[model samples]
Target chain A: MKIMHCPLNGPRNISEFAYGGQVEVMPDPHQCSDKDWASYVFYEKNAIGVVKEWWQHSPSSYWFIAERHNASDDILRTYDPSELFSERVDFTTGENEP
Target chain B: MTTGLVSPKRCADSHGDRHNDGLKLHDLSLATRSGVRGVKASEWLIAQSLHQELKTHELQPPELQPNTLVELPGSRLLMALSTREFWLLEPETEAQASPIPSGHCAPGVWPLYNQNSHAWLVLSGEPRAEMMAKLCGVDLRIEAFPVGTVAQTQMALASVVIAHHLWRDEAVFSLFVDQSLADFAWEALQDAMEEFNSVQ
Candidate 1:
């Protein structure tokens, strides 16, 4: 069985992980066009080269990021999301508007 | 504090041979356990513990690292699931009070419903790791997962937190799983332990 290294729990069976879609910049829901919002939620780059993606360790329910090659199916490196996200994102919505 | 709590695994107490080299299983669901989680959970717990120590004039417990278990006063076990999540376990003590609802215990620390949401099971014996191999993927041998080690992994297709620590000087594996799956996990463990039953 294949093994995948988790940012929290070390290497575990591939079965213990669920592949989340590739990491992408989100368009502001209230500021961006409807088309842009839909594309951001439904679409992926799906390129052939190495890309960053989100992965969850089912047992611990921990989510982290992983760099992997699409064609070779090789995991380049894995790390905690804190490395990329330094601050929390706050969305200004109609209900919370001052 | 006595809440007259009952364990989900009724057969746990009746089972298990605690003698050295004998495979045993005990159900500790009725034991006292509580948890906290949040970015400031660790800091808050440490502060609270220190406050209690001062009030009682007792020594405070040591610092805990991720995936590690530390012994505390009154036979309590402090297990760190992550830097921000921790479980305080009193395996020998029965539940006295009702579970606290989910809410802020401190500024950024929130209480967990683990006392009510999870069942506790403990396994002991010389070949405990071998028995676990039948149901789990992690290496649980004492050398690999030494005493005081904690692992959050899957056993018998169910999520479980396994803590290896010394109980009364004897090594044991303490498992925590969802209360709803207590019987299933217990039965699965019993089945894997059948071969060692004769050794007891």
Candidate 2:
């Protein structure tokens, strides 16, 4: 159990956390149905290697980010959960996009 | 025999109030302070320098690894792992409201807060594990959990701190949780132990 420092809540209690996979799997709301939304929200596949996972700070009222190596069971990095939700923008056109 | 009278020894009332004689149950009220505090190596060095009084054989120092359990003298068990680590399971006497001695750390440097908000439930008898498991999610297997071990986890929808202590006559556990959740946890355990004829 390697210690993963969380940016939002420094030094979180590890056991109170549940890993959600690959940080890059953003569902397309336009194409996704209610069932698809439900599955995306509830179900998860425990994949190995560079998987983006969701974690809940159940004890603390804070959301944060973490990176872990599933194959070796090692924690790579952690950051604030809001970091992933930052608004994306087209820097070339100076237009804000998500 | 023809009168169908039951023997006095066989009567239920003759057994007395069994629950009344059991361990006195108290309503624990306290708050939970959560966060990790670092322990300086200097403190460990000082504790080691104290007059070594070896009474009972302490378990061999567990390999320096994550989540390893270390049993110290005076029934003290320490959980070594993570930056915010080391849980001391002192005897019931140690939980009383008293200032812990200083010198392990520089005077007034290390602040130790009173963790009384942790409601402690002392469970004894043979069915302790069974009763506890019904409320907690952790596996309390004997092989996984030996005597003089401590675990921090959730129980009955509440965060719990549990330590197992083995005695010659009976086995026991010291369970702690937030004071606000005490009644909820107590009721949950009692309801789970209903089939076992729990006493107090």
Candidate 3:
């Protein structure tokens, strides 16, 4: 069985993980067009080489980032989301802005 | 101690009744357990421990590393799943009558409904790890998992948290699974334990 290393739980059977889609930054709803927002929500680059994606360890319900090669299906590196998001990000619309 | 909440496995008339000479499984669904998680959970738990020590004049609990558990006074155990998550387990004690409301236990520390969300099962035997190997992919032998180890992994295709610890002077595996899947997990464990029933 294929194995995937979880940032929190260590190496575990691939069956224990669910592949979340590619990580993407959210566009400000107040600034971006609806179509652009929709694209951000539902679209993926689906590139060939190494890509960063979100993966969840089902048992612990922990989500982390994994750099994997789509073509080879090899996980190059796995790390906690904290590595990328050091602090909370709050989004604001034109109406909510102070 | 008893809680108004009943375990999902409470309907089983034979819960905790089955036993084998070598391998035995006891349903500890009624035990007392609670959890807390957040960025400040570690410090919060340490502070709670110190407060308890000051009140009771008992030794303070030890600092727990991730994936390790430490025994505390009154037969309680403090298990750390991660630096931000910790479970307080008391297998021998039934839940208290007072309800534990769901909310923040302290600033940056949120309470978990483990007592209501999961069922507890304790497995003890000579070949306990060998039996667990049938369903779990991780190496769970004593050498690899040793006492005080906590593994949040899958078993029998179900999410389970396995804590290897000394209970009543004997090593045992304390498994916590989703409450809804309690029966299924119990059956799966029983099937794997069948072979060992005749070993001794």
- Across A12-87, the per-residue lDDT of candidate 1 in tens digits comes to 8888888888888888777889899889889887778999999999878888999999999999999999998887
- The TM-score each candidate achieves on chain A is 0.90, 0.59, 0.87
Residue A59 shift from truth in candidate 1, angstroms:
1.0
User: Considering only N, C-alpha and C atoms within 3 Å, which residue pairs clash in candidate 3?
Assistant: none
In model 1, pairs of residues that clash are B1-B96
True-vs-predicted CA distance for residue A66, candidate 3, Å: 0.5
Sliding window of 10 residues with minimal summed lDDT for model 2 chain B: B6-15
Sort every candidate by lDDT, greatest first: 3, 1, 2
lDDT of 3 by residue, B31-84 (tens): 889889998887786687545643353433335667788777777788888878
Q: Report residue A9 deviation for candidate 2 (angstroms).
A: 19
Q: Write the per-residue lDDT of candidate 1 for residues B1-200, one digit (tens) a residue.
A: 33333344443321253445667687878888988898888678768753474335342333566788877767778888888888899877897676467559888889989988899988876688988999999999877999989998899989999999887678999999999999899999888888666663
Error of 3 at A29 (Å): 3.5
Off by over 4 Å in 3: A91-98, B1-21, B50-63
What clash count does candidate 3 reach? Answer: 0
The Cα RMSD across the true interface for model 2 is 6.8
* DockQ-based ranking: 1, 3, 2
